[model samples]
Target chain A: MVMMNKEDFKTILKKDKKIIDRAFEEKFKDDNPLNEALRYATDSGKRIRPILFLESYKMLTKKSYLNDEIIEMALNIEMIHAYSLVHDDLPSMDNDDLRRGKPTVHKKFGEDIAILIGDSLLNLAFENSLNLAKNGQRFLDASLYLSKASGIDGMIKGQVYDLRRNLEIDLSYILEVYKNKTSRLFMAACVMAGLLNGLSEDKLKALENYAYYLGLSFQIQDDLLDKNEKNELNILSCKSLDEANSLLLDFNNKAKENINKFKNNDFHIYLIDYLTERTK
Target chain B: MVMMNKEDFKTILKKDKKIIDRAFEEKFKDDNPLNEALRYATDSGKRIRPILFLESYKMLTKKSYLNDEIIEMALNIEMIHAYSLVHDDLPSMDNDDLRRGKPTVHKKFGEDIAILIGDSLLNLAFENSLNLAKNGQRFLDASLYLSKASGIDGMIKGQVYDLRRNLEIDLSYILEVYKNKTSRLFMAACVMAGLLNGLSEDKLKALENYAYYLGLSFQIQDDLLDKNEKNELNILSCKSLDEANSLLLDFNNKAKENINKFKNNDFHIYLIDYLTERTK
Candidate 1:
């Protein structure tokens, strides 16, 4: 396996982020109030989902360059993420006044517009996918995988479980919330890599496993970092911080193990390292 | 064209309603809380959108039977409508406790679940569309049409506009709102019939025009009936009831004109007649 150094990793991340940024700019070319509000809502983010998506695409397809259709796929995932964040921050939900060091969409542009912004963003995600359907059945095939990951049995269900957080829940139930809330969308991005390029079944299963561990590790890290959360409180009360960190390390190690099973997996291995060590 | 008696029209409505009811039942066969909530929200509507969808499809294709793809297409429309109502009746939006003489989703399921219900329904609509994409590119083609008609520039924008309802707005502005909030989805359903069956440009254009007028007449009738809306209140204050009815007649006349342009038009004409004359 060819290894990617730190510079190679930065280059990949920067290029992927630029593609996603360009797609958003192009999709929002028309200046309307709804678009304006959507722009504000999606204005800032780490773009982690798109990064994972593009990297997975590259790793599976062995293609360094991405096409408009694939880029749009990445954008749709981010839009789904953006909209979920917007809704999750609403007064009736998490009541978060700030996100990513800026005021939440609801706080910036009234709650009503925020709701519409979230709704519009969700619709736009599908709009982008349907637009890509002109390319072939593969994009359409990938989109089914995507919508389920975002829907009732996936991310939204996780949000429901998260919102209805209970203090009495044990580690097992909290893990269920983490799987839905944090792991599913990430898993979709990773699995979409193989689904897009028609990766073999064994390799595809490996990617899915890779994504599962990646998501689990990421969520445990999130819980460890968050200063205020009912599950966080429950987590800390149930186990020691050191124990949580040990579990996270175990998941991270498992994520790396899946990556190592594939040929030409240097960059993917680098990605796992970056995510596991990511500060925020 | 075979001219139908009132009994035939009633007969068609009942049969179509039963098909839509079956589709929803089969779609929501899962007994999860989320599906249960979706079932409750989807139940008891007039099922107008799906009825129009099937009627339009039948008129264009001259087919008596609907495959699962077509039925799924119809279900997607009703899901959009159902979810929109669920969101609209939220405390943050319309705050209505009752809909169709039953407690609203939020009232019965709680606000967070209501929000998830709406989000999940939206995702399910796309999931169903993605599933139907396997039938052919036409379903994908129609899905692009469907998403745009539901997205930022369409129904959601209209909802934003409606939420910020201004009493000072004129009839022209109200018409714009009606076109976005009401006409686009109905127009999508109508135009999709031609898109799915690959109708000629002339026929498709007529379908669009037909839907435009259908939506206008329907919303105008809705406003004319509702005693609580600001625009309705404004209309009552500004003009005589007879003058408002005259405008309704003009739209209703325009709707019939478009339907008459089609060759196989008996039931389409009857559907329009029923919509305009129905007391409910």
Candidate 2:
């Protein structure tokens, strides 16, 4: 297997980011309040989720290029992510005014439009998924995987637990919050790649495990880096800084181990380190 | 054709409402905050959208009974409608303190949970739709139809129009808002029924027209009956009360005519009058 250096990883991610950004540009060209705010909310991100999806698919298919349907599916995942961030920033939620160095959706558009923007983005994600599914059964499975990950059994449940954080919190409860809120979508990204490519059930399960560990470690790293005191569900609340770091290291190791069975997995292995070891 | 009186209409509606309510009761049996608030948000809706879907399907299949998948799809439509109402009643949106003689979701369970509830319900709607679609191709088509009807091309766009109501509006603008916000879901209900039953494009077009006219008349009647003055896009703003009433009559007649071609459509025909002629 060919090993990829950090520069190669950056190059591939940049190319993938360009693909996602261009798709968003083309899809949201109309100048309306909904599209404007949608474009604004989705404008700039690391494209981490879509990149993970694309890399997973590439690892399996050995294809350097992807079809529009695959890219559209990845964009749908990003749209779900974008919508979550938009709603999370609402005054009644996280109540942040700034995101990505600009006013959030509710701050730029009115709260009504901001709420609709989030709802619209989520609906649009499924609309695109359904359209992609019309192509074949694999797409349908992928869409279902995504829908499950984002709904009550997954991300939404995580958000609910996070909101009720003050009620008899424990290490298990905080871990549950991280697993559902963060890891579910990560699992969706990877498992969707497996579903779309018709990977084996064994491989799909492995991908899910990889994503779960990756998500937990990445979230813990986020909490570690965040200077804000509002996150009562942070790992530090349950474990000391040293304990959190050791847990992060253990999770990062597990994440790499899960993907080691796949060929040409240097990028995936490096990704665990990159995501969980971010600088301030 | 079997001619039905108001008693039969009430009987069938009550039966269908029971089906929906029981499904909700079963689905939301968990006592967590999310399920509790979800049940509260969806508890007493009139089950209008789902009923429209079931009746349209019955019109095509001529079957007195439906399967669980079909019922689930119908429930999904209601879930989407319920989510819309929850979000619409948020403090940032319509700001209603009460709905159906009970506290709104945001009023009863804080604004944050209400937002998550709306997001969860919408996500849950598509999740159920995707699950139902796994039965066959027809269900997939039905799911796609519903998705488009609820997204930016449909309900969300209508909301944006409603939010931007003060922007140099006119009769056409108000009608645009009504068509998208009100009629789109009605169209989805009927069109999904047609799709699931493999109705010809001609019949689907007829169903679409029927739903459009029915929704317009329904909204006009609602505006006519509402004693509040907050609706800037109410038809009465441009038309006299007599003129608005005449227009409602015209749309109601059109609605009935579109569905008249189908045999055993008395229930559908009566639905228009039942919805438009609600007593204050």
Candidate 3:
């Protein structure tokens, strides 16, 4: 196994991001208003979700696995992420005009087109995943995991809790929000990789825990960096900056510990530190 | 074999609608804001898509099929339809306050919740469909067809064209919109049934054509009944009322002819007439 130097990890991440960007560009090159909005919505994110999926697959398969199907699955996760961001930035939602320092979908296109684009991206994710799923049961299982992680009981419920978080300020309630909203898709990323690689149940559970901790830590780090001032639910709302930082570290430590079960998990360990420590 | 009389056809339609409504109620019995919005949005719609799917399946298989899996598939299609309506009724879209004589999802709940509920319903559809897809290839194929038919190149594209219909008023453009927005899902309904029943490719094509014509005629009839006054695209805009009526008749007749190859297609033939002649 390659040593997990921070520089090497960054290089791998940059390379993976390029791969995902190229795949996304290829997927939505058609000329239409819908395609234009889709391209705009999916453009130029950090693509952490797909990279997380790719890294998890590498860790589990113990190979530099960059197959087309794997890339397609990663792209599907990214599409779901893009759709969420688009909807979250709608006029009745967060009402933001910018995403990733660029005009948000609703801002660039009209609100109507924004809504259609979000729906289109989500539908495209399923269309592509189902196409891959026709190959075998493993792909279908991976897709099913992705679906559940992003559905009513997962990400959508998190949005509902977030909208009503003012009514309840308890730590357990906040953590539940973070768990469902932020951590569910991340959990799906790792767990989908585990399912695709045919990992044992114990290893899969370990990956799930790893992803859970990693996702929570990542969200906390995001709040720490953004210093979000909105009324939306955030980890920094109740906890002081120092306490939130420590909580991030604790989750990161837990994430690193969970991946210790895998022999080739240097990238996993390095990723925990990389994500939680990143600025901006 | 039972002869398809008009009264018998109406009875079958009502029965099928009830079966679909019951399945929908069972699917969303979970108590939550998201589930509540889902139930409200799906409360009533005549259950046309699922009924079309069920009728197609019956026509092809020549069996009075009421299996749980088939009902689940039908529910999945209805969920997609319900999600579309919820999103379409948003303030930025159609801005409709009433749907099927009730307060729309956005009117009853907040727009943010409505958006989340739409996303949840769409996610739940794929989630359920993927679960069934694990059983075999037929289910997977059907789900894939549903996905493609409702995605960017299909229904979403139709919505996009609709939003920009003022930019172009050509007959071909409107027909394209009708084909993608309206016919695509209906095509998926019948073709999915064909796939599930393992019909031959030729027979599948016939079903696809039948659904296409039926869906177009249904939309024309909808425009006739609703007398849409919005600036949105409608066939009545380009053609006289009498011309639109004759066009509807032509489509219905074509739909009937396409399904003539099936020995048990009396119900399908009667459906074309019932849908086209309905006043409301």
- Native-structure RMSD, model 1: 2.0
Instruction: Give the higher-DockQ candidate: 1 or 3.
Output: 3
Give one digit per residue, the lDDT tens place, for model 2 in A99-145. 88899989999899899999999999888887887888899899899
The i-RMS of every model, in angstroms, reads 1.1, 1.4, 1.0
Candidate 1 vs candidate 3, TM-score winner? 3
Q: Candidate 3 has which clashing residue pairs, if any?
A: none
Q: Write the per-residue lDDT of candidate 2 for residues B1-280, one digit (tens) a residue.
A: 5788989988999999999999888998875558888888888978989999999888789998989988899888998899999999898788899899999999999999999999999998878887877788898889889998998888988988787776677778888899999999999999999998898999899999999999999899888888475754688888899999899989998998889878889889889989998866
Give the higher-lDDT candidate: 1 or 2: 2
Looking at model 3 chain A, report the run of 10 residues with the lowest lDDT sum.
A163-172
Model 2: which residue pairs collide?
Answer: none
Off by over 4 Å in 3: none
- By DockQ, the best candidate is 3
Instruction: For candidate 2, give the docking quality class from DockQ.
Output: medium
- How would you encode candidate 1's per-residue C-alpha lDDT over B85-184 as one tens digit per residue? 9998888787889899899999999887888888888999988888888888778778778898998888997887778876677777777788888899
Rank order by lDDT, top first?
A: 2, 3, 1
Model 2: how far residue A250 lies from native, Å: 0.6
